[model samples]
Target chain A: MRYAYYPGCSAHSTARDMHESADAVARLLGIDLVEMKGWSCCGATSAHQTDRVMAASLPAANLLLAKEMGLDTVVTCAACYSRMKTANHEITSSADMRAAVADAVGQPYDGSVKVRHFVEILLEDFGIDKLRKRFKKSLNGLKVASYYGCLLVRPGNVTHFDDPENPTSLDRLVTAMGGESIDWPHKVECCGGGLNLTRTDVAVKLSSSIVEMAAASGADCIAVACPMCQASLDLRQKDIDAATGKKHHMPVLYITQLLGLCLGIPEKELGLSRLMVSPAGVLKALQPASSHQV
Target chain B: MTIKIKKQSGKSLRQTVEEMSGVDMSLCYQCKKCASGCPVTKYTQSPPSEIIRRLHLGAGDELLESDLVWMCLSCETCYGRCPMDINIPAVIDALRSLALEKGSKSPRGDMPLFNRKFLEAVKAYGRSYDLSMIMGYKLGSGSLMQDVEKFPSMLAKGKMAVLPPSGAEKKVVKRIFDRSKQAKGKKK
Candidate 1:
């Protein structure tokens, strides 16, 4: 019931909704999330690409804290989860590498800390049946495209969370909330991620296809776990549409936000309005159409 | 787009990549599976498979200088699909590090700038300070106008804070960066 929460940089910024709704939902479910004190960045793509030792060392510092706490680390950002898991895999797999990381971090870590993505925690820690019983409202008539993006389920051996090719954890979560998770091919595709800052054109080109495919699958909105994917699909959506010459007004919602909505959490409290594309249309579907006097 | 294959001598590219990345590209047998699975392959002149192929053919410097390495999304699709279990992302990471270390100008645009600023922010604050990173990125990359319209709204919604956050372990983070820098210097 207790987890050392490692909400990455995104949780404080662009994807605040994911962090807020995750806290709200976990509290409602009787799960305690203790924020890992003095935790730093996970190094993300920048560290690994720049220095291998620093990349592994950054996550090692956090994992050492988690080990000290004697609790499993739960990460909401897929990029952070991937980095931490990769660091864990690398450090544990090689003695020399482990020593180098320990030397850099000024502490020896045995990689004993278990890193779990928020999706995995929701699925494995909080059983689907138990979650189903707790839903106060239904997501009926809501068709959602579960966007896994890349990190959460890639390099199968290192992540070991779900099938890298085709994951159904998000779909199962959607189904448990009385919503339909659309089957789509672009579920595991790259959203150009950090490339948004480095290469906006590529991000737009890649995110456009994801949005187009989600809409083509008849999804009212896209559910994402990673803030990078959420930002790509939500913030750059306007550019994607402008470039593609398509009017796909698809709303991107975090998986936590979607779950919180079904749990009857208020929209504002979940930071729903922070999304670039408005999720109002999809949210309004919760009410009977006949009841509205429009 | 003809890749002039020059058979070079003395510590081949494959050996260097393998030594640095700990991933033996010699295990790659022209499967092209990695290239096929790579999402950014279309964006690059040479795909992951071709990069490995060139490395297999004793290709060097060219692969390092190529934009293909910079364009790699590092999505790990290639790594996951490799039958030989070749970690392509790690290899590309090694290539990137080598390229940057050698003072080779990045052919793929402002990625190096953004990455440098991002890490600089992390080194200073122990985490990414969005406002500072943006300002630094804008100054370094001159991308001031991009995504400018969303600033006010993001600020109003409390999505981005105007001030930077000093993480509790800033000194520890500084030490980590210093150690890595010293280690890299020793390696050179």
Candidate 2:
């Protein structure tokens, strides 16, 4: 299967690991991810709040580009997927909005291209059973909390792939990769997103709750889909600890990275080190030899 | 003491909450999982579960003035723990928006000031510049003297950049702002 890919801004910069793991996983699954060239930012939390039209238009432009390529677009970032899906929904549903958006971008948005999350591509297109068969190293003992932030699931009409309220796609993916998934509160919480900059105290407080809950649930690490979610939880973890005076630091990993590791991809290549909290211990714990050797 | 049975206005608070949040408020089966997991509820007059229960019982007007709306960090703990998947944060956001529309001031004194400072920071800079945001918050909040020590370190570590990053597309961003304002005006 081939997909026109939208990596969004974070994938190009801070969350480059998502791109790496996604590319690796795509290659392993024999799916072609041709990136949409010269794509701009998706106007995530900031854009939508500041300007709804631009938020929808920016992602809609990318969709127009994808339609030009004549293939469905797959977005790696949850925010990007949400924005694009929202834009797609708006354009397809409202003729006036579509015409206005098309005029703004100087391209006709025929609403032909479909926006898909990488998770959807993995589960629906690639199939979990097929993924399970390819896992060389099973994450047998690793307890992972599947953290699906707000974007991927909410506004269910646009996303449409999973149960917005009780999403099991990521959990299913983790289980297929041979890891035990933990039930934890804040799995679908907003990881404070761009609100990190505007409201540092609130962001820290919010993220701390998630990390604390994950630790309490016996999760060694939390797996996530959105780059922003990973950054807010993983990068600001130290700040969260400082604010809350809690020592809990559960490592945050991309679902693709977990899948890549289970499929026997090297940790360094997947950019695992980029995380503030190292997943080496978690990875070691998952390996069978570490159990007997320790 | 008998709790006074006030006559409900006959509208389902669950439906109202769902309409505002895009979350099915009916999913909350009064498990109190949300209350158990909530961080801010400890600091608020009402816990998250109670807030939902009140909303479920058509206590819509009461929620408009409740301190619980402003206190919500939008952490989404209730949404995650809710077996029925109720998005408490969104419901809170909706309530806060409603309060803002109704000209209801934040009872917790610092919160409204914080909101104004935040919007000022955003309005000045296309994107939020941390230094400006912090300085604005401190000045507006009268907490400048308290956090004086941390400011210098934040600057040294590059955590707080001097200038805000320009919006990705400034012209377009301005247009969005203007249009949204116009949209709001039209709604009014």
Candidate 1 per-residue C-alpha lDDT over B1-188 given as tens digits, one digit per residue, 9 for 90 to 100: 67787777788878888987998776889889988888777787888888888887778676787877778889998988999999989999999888888877766556777788889989888889888877888887777898898788789877787777655578778889999899889977
lDDT tens per residue, model 1, A1-294: 899999888777777888999999888889899999999998989899998989999999998888888899999999999999999999999898899998999989877799998788888988887888777777775899999988999989999978898999999998777778888899899988768877788878988889999988999998999988988888788788898998889999998998888878888778888887899877876642221111
Across B1-188, the per-residue lDDT of candidate 2 in tens digits comes to: 22122455665555655754566766778989988766655556788888777766667565667767766654455665677766676577666655665677655435555555544544454344446655776777666765365455434433345655443334433444455456556646
Candidate 2 error regions (>4 Å): A110-112, A288-294, B1-188
**Could you tell me which 10 consecutive residues in candidate 1 chain A have the lowest summed lDDT?**
A285-294
Worst 10 residues of 2 chain A by lDDT: A285-294
After aligning candidate 2 to the native by TM-score, how far in Å is the CA of A88 from where it should be?
2.0
CAPRI tier for the interface of model 1: medium
What lDDT does the true structure give each of the candidates?
Answer: 0.85, 0.70
Docking class of 2: incorrect
